[model samples]
Target: MEISFVRIDDRLIHGQVATIWTKTSKCNRIMACSDEVAKDDLRKTLLLQVAPPEIKAYVLTIDKAIDAYKNPKYDSFKTLFLFTNPKDVVRMVKAGVPIKSVNVGGMCYKEGKIQITSAVSVSEEDIDAFKTLNEKGIELELRQVASENKVSLMSRLDSLKLI
Candidate 1:
């Protein structure tokens, strides 16, 4: 499956994720690759329930997400892989996950973060990590809804002199 987006949303999956991202991307699957959420059956079930029946959901650890996505089993469906935080995306990229860019959706406003002038807040670590990706030609965008403009985290990092 072609991954239309690699998003960093701490909520993992929810209403806007189901209706907005899925509809906008026209994806057939939603994969929540989170270590904590993957182990919690209840939360997994809850997240899965929010999605339409056609859009399959998988809650997985970073390793499992890398392994599963690399395999041929899910090659037929278009995917939108969701990571709970920027650290996970950094880890995935460090672990050789096949992601070119990361989209920041929602995460609490944290201290020392350049908010990137978007709905999400990013930390100094995120700025550094995103800068690493940007240097590697991976774009980091911030957006809550599909219609909104994608704010480049790279530029924000530059503004903070983090890049």
Candidate 2:
């Protein structure tokens, strides 16, 4: 599978993803990789249902996603990968998925997390995962929509003294 785009959005397959990012990436498939979601039949079905008719969708566990990504049968698939958190991204990357960059789309507000951008909030664990991705040469970009200018997430973290 050719991963055309990788985004970390807490709300997996929402409006912005269904419209903007999908068109921007020109991906034919939307793969939401999360162990939690994959285990929930209702959520998995809901996510798959929301995808545009022209595009194929799959909600797979991290291990399954990694296997599919490495499998030759999926070589023709142009996929846009979505994860709920940076920790999952790190897991895939560490498992040897060749992700060159990742979009930090929306992390949302959580009890202990600090707002990094209007759309992103991160806790210490998220910060460490992002730092790990950065160290591995993965470019972390921050943008809520396709039309917006991409911001370097690491730079912002540095400027904010969060890392």
TM-score of 2: 0.98
Model 1 alpha-carbon drift over 4 Å, by segment: 110-118, 161-163
TM-score of each: 0.88, 0.98
- Candidate 1, residue 142: Cα displacement in angstroms equals 1.4
Cα RMSD of all models vs. native, in order, equals 2.0, 0.7
The positional error of residue 156 in candidate 1, measured at the CA in angstroms, is 1.7
Off by over 4 Å in 2: none
Whole-model Cα lDDT per candidate?
0.80, 0.95
Worst 10-residue lDDT window for candidate 2 reads: 44-53
Candidate 2 accuracy as lDDT: 0.95
